[model samples]
Target: MSKSAVPVNLTDRLSQFSELWSQKKVAVLNDYEVKLAKLKGEFVWHTHEDTDELFLVISGRLTIQLRDADVVLEPGELFVVPRGVEHCPVAHEETAILLFEPEGTLNTGDAGGPMTKVAETLR
Candidate 1:
């Protein structure tokens, strides 16, 4: 297929990675990157001080737990977590999500730990 005509399938891209909480870049648009993450259990309570994070559920259910409330998301639903707002993501089962954020935004945010990853594209 022509490089520009190639299709990026969420289900297909999701099959490339199994590690929870780690993200794989699927596309780039100007200064932003499109990422896919497989989430299970609870993620670190973190805040992206420099950029807002957009989370779009592709399959299964996802809950964004904030200090004030929990935002529940299902397939095709999206929520944007504003910059610097501390939050955590929890998935009781394997959940797939699409994220849109500025390039270089770390997966672990300011709560960096072993989960911090050097961002790279998967396809």
Candidate 2:
């Protein structure tokens, strides 16, 4: 990717990013990739077999909806959805979110639920 293709600051990039559910990749590890996203409304219920997903709320409020439980996150708050567990997401107010998960982790989880986005890399 070109110099222009990279974001000067991932935090700064949050404002112009999509308010809907989507992943804008930032960095990576041997088995994981980090992404930043803006979330609002409800997402689909889904799960991942081999990878657990981490969620950190940078700003605003976010809610993780699971089959048996739900977690509400305020700014600076975080939660994890374990591997093979099903969960959905919802945000009453627009929220900035960060995630760390395996490289090929499916956004909609294993079944390709409705919240899935065609993930993208920053550089």
Q: Which 10-residue span in candidate 1 carries the lowest summed lDDT?
A: 114-123
Please estimate how well model 2 matches the true structure, expressed as its whole-model Cα lDDT.
0.82
- Estimate the TM-score of every prediction: 0.94, 0.85
TM for candidate 1 is 0.94
lDDT of model 2, residue 120: 84
Best-fitting candidate, scored by TM-score:
1
What digit string (tens of lDDT, one per residue) describes model 1 on residues 45-76? 99999999999999999999999999999999
